[model samples]
Target: MPSVLEIRWIMRPASLLVVVAAACVGEPDSSPWSVADSAGVRVVEIAVEPVALPVYASVGELEFTVGSIDGTDGPAFGDVGEVRSLPGGDVLVTESRSQTVGVYDRSGRTLARMGGRGDGPGEFRFLHVAGVAGDTLWIWDPIPQRLTPLSRSGRVWPVVTFEHELADRPGDLRRLADGGFVARTRFQPLDPLDPKYAESKVWTDSLVLRRLDAEGLEIDTIAIAAAEQLLREIWPSPTGEGDGRPVGAMLPFGTQAHWAIDSIGNSVVVDGTSGQMVLRDVRGSIRTVVRFASPPRPLPEAEVERLRRSRLDDVESSPFRPMVERVFSKELLPTAFPRVGGLLVGESGTIWVAQYATFPEEVTEWTAFAPDGEPLGRLSLPARFQAREFGEAYVLGAHTDEFGVQRVQRYRLERP
Candidate 1:
């Protein structure tokens, strides 16, 4: 395993970062778990047994909620991007509709509001509260392609800009342990002149995750994983004046790659086909592989049909609704559910993997693994609650009411 060791230079005028490869100290385990050394790298393989019981039945104590539909307190968020709990009882929320970040107390009272709809240094076009580093919060704006630092007291710091190529619609922005960041460049534009572009229904490619320093400079290129397959159909323009436009969404029930950044700045990738997870360091070296023994469950046809109908209803108001309807069908759905749905790494370095759920009425199962790859058992929560951040004692999530009003909710993490 390679460990980072900072050493000051005696003769040189500047400091240099060095990585030292350490020798493996532990012995290999038998059958279910094993450790091996390959090409100067330590690899730990864990074969996890199927967990039968959940650690918690419901983790909902409802510590606090901040939002409303009546617009009574100006906290009526239109499209909430992210939520993070502060050091005290304050909660930071990002609303893309207003391009604002609102800080609220535990009682849902607004403490401070920052940013607005503009392209200025402090303003935002598509604002998202990415993560917090010490007393500063990092805000991601993909439209103008920049990361703006905001203080807890609503102070705006110097903005960090990115190159146009690197900032063109990146995926998730994860904060590193050393105050850096990693952004995943998800898609590659299709060539319009290519014959395959007109004939292909599903396009598959690789996604590149780039690592940037705290100053927003590209420092290293991280791992490349399979991108989500696009399910699209070519539709002629409504005006019938130009080339056909490709209208589609990510393929439902398709096997793709899901990843999360650990507390120590390592990247963990897992393909949805199975319960295998690959852990790599910042230099993109495979350090470990965690695999669960359970196989994928068979997906019911009725459930697939239900999901298709739900997706069609979501795009009912779109102009490409007809093309989307043609793209979503039972035949296009996978026969078995993806073993891994999503991945989340807690602030304590504990890894949580969520099970795939097709509907809100279903129960979402999350299995936690230690930093060393030991299974910590599973937990269950309502599918309606979308968890944004998970800590040892609490989970911050977004809950939508029956009237479609968004609310930031903090729930106590209850375990047996």
Candidate 2:
């Protein structure tokens, strides 16, 4: 077994910025852990076990401020997409609205502003914050299909073109351990009944994850997509339509996608969106699979309605409210709750799988798993905060105020 020192540097310079974590001391347990409740799924035995309670209150409260909002020369996020912890207790955030990336310290002071929106060298036409590779920050702009490296000192490295010859559009782009990249492609939806969808260019789909080398060439297949078919519109509508839906009504809901890459670039993918969590290593092979012992039952009709109503209450005002009502129709909610709503890979190789809340106002539950595929404990987050990145003790996520102002917040978790 590799020593903790080796595992700590699995991704090396690329991962050094994510977190300068303490090495996990000890060898991995090779014995398989089985569960009758998991439909006979195979597991692995690890020395670690659950040491905490079932719920972690105040975690979602966003009261513990490890990082704050900066509006000066730093970052005032109009639309926050991703947040990541840096080496020196700093954090990196991607603001999609303004097409910029900023680095902030624990006190919320701006360490550096990487780049702004533009078509020039440092200017980003399609801003995509990939990951930290030592002093180089990898950003991919899929529109121009280029991977541009931003130096730690704010210089633009030579652009690496992504000659994406795939049949599907790519979604999640994770820079891998060997300087390669792993991407999620969109799956093509079936024939569209609406004329507007006849040529939907930006709808999201992917039944499999693809890996590319450092040069942006296809290397291997990470994991196969779920068997389930879900059509999610990607592009936003002009005015009346929300999320590419028609002005008055919406199309069928798509499957919620949740996956996380560990410090080494190995991914934890939620299979079937419910039954299984597949752990694929850097070699594009399934190292061990993690299954939930007692999975929650699908949401019942009443619960589904309650969820829908909860959303309706959130709309402060809508000029298209009347139009939305006239044609507003929806397919039945998925029988089960979202298989997996969110995923976070801890710096220590632990996994946090977040389940969807019936409503945004309710608490969110997360199943924790050890590095060796052992199901640790579960925690219930007190409220809604869309977590973008996490560390040993804090969750840095995007939170919208009651007034609809977006802010990047850091919520510290107290196990007690």
Candidate 3:
């Protein structure tokens, strides 16, 4: 009988096999499965349908150009978490590794670096995310699990820490129209013996979206099981070792995934690994699955049987194994890519999606789309950029290496 490695090689398409083999560089059995070619790329040929409201043009382009923003010494600004725009055209950036939120002007010059890694009044143990509302800046520190509010003038207020049952780790915080803010909490791992095998086994677990009032009280919650199922269906399952145990089960993965809320409180949750996005209406009863991609084809029955009979050691050390891991790695896995990277819902119900692409040098680009899912233009930048919203402006938080020094750049959009 042929070995499991041989069977996997035979099942993979010729074109994909060559690509995988090249990536493996003579390594044994590294390739897993070939993803659908159509996955990850944008949907370009869908027919437009009429809705209750008018369908306006929803596509725009992003003309992003890199700028010089110097503040802080080398190694000061680390990996960026969130880039938020203030009311007066300034941008606030959370340096997760450096434990500081660097404030910058619209032109990319740093004005201030707020807070460090500490437990003091203004300090943050771990800065996970950030947002801006009027003159206030909200930073989420997961270690302390509190929201640290800072004034534009750099005065720190008493932290808003919620009860553990309300939210263990805060995801994203957005300002509401009613002077309150909405906070999102991710799903936690249930008891290992729980019957929900799939939820507990997956690295990126499902998430639960919760709305918080000004007093940090939980006002509402949205179950994301449907979204999780949808994403799993879209991405190929990691290789199952003997006894059919998935490799991802042992790896640490993020659970917050992606989330966004509109002016009317409608929420869109994205599970990139599953290629599924769930849109929940304000009433919560209205849930719709937005399918963006398809998973790789499964192995044939004969091939499956061959793999089952193959020796464990021979299979584990095969070149095809690395290929499988590479195909499923977040970088190459088509299902792991987000359909729309940075999503924002406008007050007028205009849904804007930033198509994000990241390259090896930390370069990133974002393409904008209208609320009706129309393609807008694209934004290209030289650094890593994450989307943030503040009132009418769209903020792009970026991290770049300038002559061996790390810097943060805030790019704000002036919508026409």
Candidate 4:
């Protein structure tokens, strides 16, 4: 395991002014309406209108399959991070653990595996995600705080390093038209003793989103709370405690910021725990868009009673016990936030979002929207392929683990 100390030492400093500038340009607004269940979890319903058309099956919808490639002769991939569609139907996949890059064809064949684990010009120790801008592949290594450009042929370009303090883990990277990029940084409260330790923080706080430049410079930083209020109309309390606590007192615990950036550098930061999505434009106008109704499940009252009697000694045995206790002990239940599985912005300003019926499931349903964020239609993906984007076609990726063996597969989106 990589130590937190090492991660901090490798941190790079980037321009924070860019992020501030970006956040300043957006119009701050709240969601139009909100609804809540008996459990006190707010739910917002987005009015979706479906498009009428004879849906045709996309190319290679079921035409592709997963295959194994030898990593000994090429770059090895440990844990796959983000995968993106290249211009010529190719794909770029990030391997975090191994600190390498995997290039595959549309058919899932490994064309070339490049990049290595090092701090040198063409090397990387950890990378979060990558995006393609024109002919260059931009890889974002959050730990090192740098964005290194690579050629399609697996050659590394000059390194662009930035000086900035990024939270422990960084989010996805999106390519912009002006030859720059925007990425999100997630912040967690550092444990006084162990600064990087993360425990039961998910239920009570919101995360911060910092926009970075192409060189890993900080361009702007936006509180998830402000974004949530403007886009989802849901204002999350910063204090983990609900009543009497000042607003924006405590940051989001566990995982709070979930977002994706489009080709235009616009970002959609979704707070699944809060049922809000912060839509940020290039000019820094922020809109809180809320859609998705909380599920009908009531608070697990019986579980609450059981927890009260459970011994503190028993709780120490399981780390999850405290989280469960916190929720039930406080008369809270598991809330449902609309899962934005994948986001894609087309060349024509069309936005496609893959929605999950449940959390962490491979099967996905997709919705299309115009540039103005109007809903267009919905489509379901095939069982095996995990849907990412839906537009003139669909893009899907899948990871399988059977009998301890792991493999990844990609397929074209098809509509029927």
User: TM-score of each candidate?
Assistant: 0.80, 0.70, 0.57, 0.61
lDDT of 3 at 181: 55
Stretches off by above 4 angstroms in model 1 are 1-60, 69-74, 117-121, 163-169, 187-189, 233-244, 360-363
lDDT of 3 by residue, 1-416 (tens): 54222233344336534654574566433422112223333232211211111222221334232233343332245466666556676666676676887666655565766888888888988775445667777777766767888887778888887653564456556655554556655567534333454332343455666666667677777545522321221122356433233233212112225677664456766553443445555544334454432332332444333323442334587634543343233432332333333455544444444433322233244433333232233444434444444233344445445464444443445532
Query: Candidate 2, residue 312: CA error in Å?
Result: 7.2
Best-matching candidate per TM-score: 1
- Residue-level lDDT tens digits of model 2 in 1-416: 66322364353344322221222223222322332223444454323222232333236345423333455534466777777776766677777777787877766667677767878777676677777878788887777666788876667888877665764556557786567777776556444445556442223344667777776677677777644333322235567454454222331223545676754567777753454677677766676666544444566677655645644555548654443332223443355655465677877676777756654434366766655455545765545457666565776776666755566677777654
lDDT of 3 at 40: 36
Better of 2 and 3 by lDDT: 2
Clashing pairs in 2: 13-134, 33-43, 186-205, 186-206, 187-205, 187-206, 207-225, 273-339, 298-336
Give lDDT: candidate 3, residue 416: 27
- Candidate 4, residues 146-256: lDDT per residue as tens digits? 778888788888877556555544544555656665655445643323322223322333356566665556777643552221111112235755422111121111123
Best by lDDT: 1
**Which of 1 and 4 is the better model by TM-score?**
1
TM-score of 3: 0.57
Q: Tens-digit lDDT track for model 1 on 1-416? A: 33221111121112111101111223223333445566755455545443462253258588878887876854788878778878876888888788898888887888888999999888988776667777788888877777888987789999876553553366557677687788877546565445566653776656677787776677777777786767655666679977877665677777678888753467778777676777677677776677655456898878778887888888789775765665556566678887777787776666778777775335367877655454556777655777778887888878776777888888888765
Question: lDDT values of the candidates?
Answer: 0.70, 0.59, 0.48, 0.50
Q: After superposition, how far is residue 264 of candidate 1 from its true place, in Å?
A: 4.4
